[model samples]
Target: MDIRQLKYFVAIVDAGSLSKAAQKLYIAQPSLSQQMAALEDELETQLLLRSARGVKPTTAGHALYQRARAILRQMEQLRADVREDGGSESGMVAVGLPTTIAAVLAVPLFEHVRKHFPGIRLQIFESMSGYISEMLPDGRLDLAILFRDSETHGMSVIPAFDEELYVFGHAGLKLRKTATTCPLSALAGVPLVTPGTVNNLRLLIERTFLREEVELHIVGDIDSLPALMAIAHGGSACTILPASAMLHRAENARPPMRRIVAPDMSRPASVCWSHALPVSAAALAVRKAMVGLIGQLHADGRWPGITLRPPPDAATLEDTSGSV
Candidate 1:
């Protein structure tokens, strides 16, 4: 019935126990139970089914939970949008970053926001691209950078850039150094250290190999980029990734990056946000900052093996000019 009741309900469902939810909310168990009972009485429907183990949402409870979360997020966004300091935008913006791009963008983003939008607080979530994509539809993230441009219902996708995947390894690799690109077939039988199968990048590599009829010889299934880099630098095996992954390490004696060719494969990155929710001014500002930074990075040629893409048309350009 009210935001307070909704919050309590959501917490109960999340924690899966009335006592735990009460403890988390810093309220007595009886008080929390009375609140839930009142909410259910007002709605004339059971919002949660209680058992010895915990509580679970029924069909109606599940619906209310989903709607309550969206409503709460919107209310928070509205409050943030209205709050300003000295005629400057001031609010919190939660953004997601894929691991590969996070390595290059995280520090610069934090520095840029701190220097420019000091009042606008930023919360950056770094994870694999697939997990980032999953967060876009929900209110968990205000915006995220996703690797694929696939059509996502109820979300706006802005094409950011296209980055070419490359084969990185120590100087001892047998590949030719004269050419910028090595054939896809050349990677056959060569040991590779890559992310686990759950990673979208790893899946892309597998699909590419299947399409090219080449065998992928994966020796190490590393989930961490730093670990992969260490393995590559130590001459244990080679790794595949966009050139941005190797950029920061260049000064520290990183390995060589040769473009993968003979059916060249590349992944397109896009910035996505929920269309169902209102875009707050703070989020828009952060989005603009991100777009400008990516453009600057690309123009300087510091973001190697990547090409900035055109922004979405005016129709898809809702609220912010920020592209992926």
Candidate 2:
């Protein structure tokens, strides 16, 4: 019925419960429930079905949720456009990052945006790449930098770079390192602590190993980056990740890392956003800043172990110019 109610409705649906959404929105549960009730009363329809597990959107609620997201996005865009007409890019842009790369890009990206587009607010969501991909269609995220298995789902994909995987563990681990690289066959008996199958990186590693006839020993399945790094740092198991991850780890203390070779494995990283949703000027500015920072990082050898890839189309150049 109102923009505030629509926002509350969308947040509730995304969080899957009134309590959780209330906490996320920093509002009291009773207040959130009252708002939803008022919204339902105004709309003259049942919007949610309550269950022991959580609340789910009813048929009507589901339709409203989708439209509400679009409405909210457009409203935010309108605000940004007004600011842009005043010669300022000022709005919130949600960026999604994979756990592994979050450590690598989070700070630098923030610093870049702050210096270049002080009027724009950047909200970074760190999660598994699969989860980040889900946020695009739901309107929870305006832009995302993540790994791709060649699927865009009608969204625009701007290739950021290609990152080579590596075997990383404690310094005491017996690794056959030659020129800072190790053969994949050497990992037959090596214990690996990796992300769960829900992660795109994990799936890529599995598929590559299967194709190359290498036996990958799975010692742990961790979805948390800190936990995975702790396991590797404690000499429990080696982790297979991109060079940027190792670079992040090495910042605290240099750990043993060797590039995976003998049929090298790498994954493509890209910036993606939903094509169906209109891109706000704020989101576009943030996107360009991100791409430029990544390019600068790769060119300066700051983002180690990744090869910079060209954008799939010329739109990147067009959108980037004068965006910041």
Largest lDDT belongs to which candidate? 1
Candidate 2: worst-modelled 10 consecutive residues by lDDT: 315-324
The numbered model that scores best in TM-score is: 2
- Per-residue lDDT of model 1, residues 9-106, tens digit only: 97888788999999999999999999999999999998899999899989999778767766776676557656653335666788999888988888
The models' CA-based lDDT, in order, is 0.80, 0.79
TM per model?
0.80, 0.86
Which residue pairs clash within candidate 1?
160-324
lDDT of 2 by residue, 1-324 (tens): 788999999999998999999999999999999999999998899999999999998999987876788788778767776867853677788899987778778999999889888888899999888899788766678788878625456576678888888877743345554448888887776788888888888899889889988887887888877777777777768888876675555465545778889988899888887654567667877887788888887778788888888644555544432111
Runs off by more than 4 Å, candidate 1: 8-65, 85-88, 170-173, 177-180, 250-253, 313-315, 319-324
Overall local distance difference test of candidate 1: 0.80
- Segments in model 2 whose C-alpha atoms lie over 4 Å from true places: 23-31, 34-49, 58-63, 83-87, 149-151, 170-174, 177-179, 250-253, 311-313, 316-324
